[model samples]
Target: MSIKPAIFLPELLRHLFKRPVTVKYPFEKEPVPKDFRGNVVFDPPKCIGCMICVNDCPAEAIEIIRVSETEKKFKMLLHNDRCIHCAQCVDSCPTKAYHMDSEYEIAAFSRRHLKIEYK
Candidate 1:
């Protein structure tokens, strides 16, 4: 069958007079939802070296390291480049050390800039 441009004409006309539904992003931003998962926020002090966040990440983007072997202090590294932002780390963390951030503007010039280490 041949394509018809007229089929879309009525739908286009109906929306033409109405105010634009598109947002003026960058200039203005819509508020994120209360439970929106944007990025990983790690609190070093709250972490108990459980390594559950590291093990449970589906993307394998997170790493937990021992900062001090004698003191059991741990450090966490979040590879945002590989992160899917599923908030699995937040859910898996028993100590509430990991939480999702609200900021969605996660763009970076380089991949290296996306890697975040928490100590």
Candidate 2:
């Protein structure tokens, strides 16, 4: 097979001179669209301690701990690392305790930081 550098050179040079296609991340922030599921936000006041969200969650990221049986108080532990962000918790919660947050830049150096606790 014969090789021709001249045929590819023009196409490469044309794209090289043109402006880059990628958006400058960090320098320019992109907004999260409406109803975009980023992170799970737990509302303690709205929680009913049903554990529906915990059961429905495919990743088993949500844990509902009953703080007080008489008081009906509950604590929610959300593992961001384990969470698939499927929004199943939000949908499954009978009391609407789980909601999705707009903040998508949830990068962390340690897994401990990713764990969110709601009381």
Candidate 1 lDDT over 1-119, as tens digits, reads 97587998888899998999889998999999999999998898888887778788999999898889788788888899999999988888888998898989999999999999988
Largest TM-score belongs to which candidate? 1
In order, the Cα lDDT scores of the candidates are 0.89, 0.89
Error of 1 at 31 (Å): 0.5
Q: In candidate 2, what residue range of length 10 has the lowest lDDT sum?
A: 45-54
lDDT of 2 by residue, 1-119 (tens): 87699998999999989998888888888887998999999889888888788789999898889888688888899999999999999888888887898988999999999999999
Error of 1 at 6 (Å): 20
Estimate the lDDT of model 1.
0.89
Which pairs clash in model 1? none
Give the distance in Å from residue 103's predicted Cα in candidate 2 to where it truly belongs: 1.3
Q: After superposition, how far is residue 85 of candidate 1 from its true place, in Å?
A: 0.6
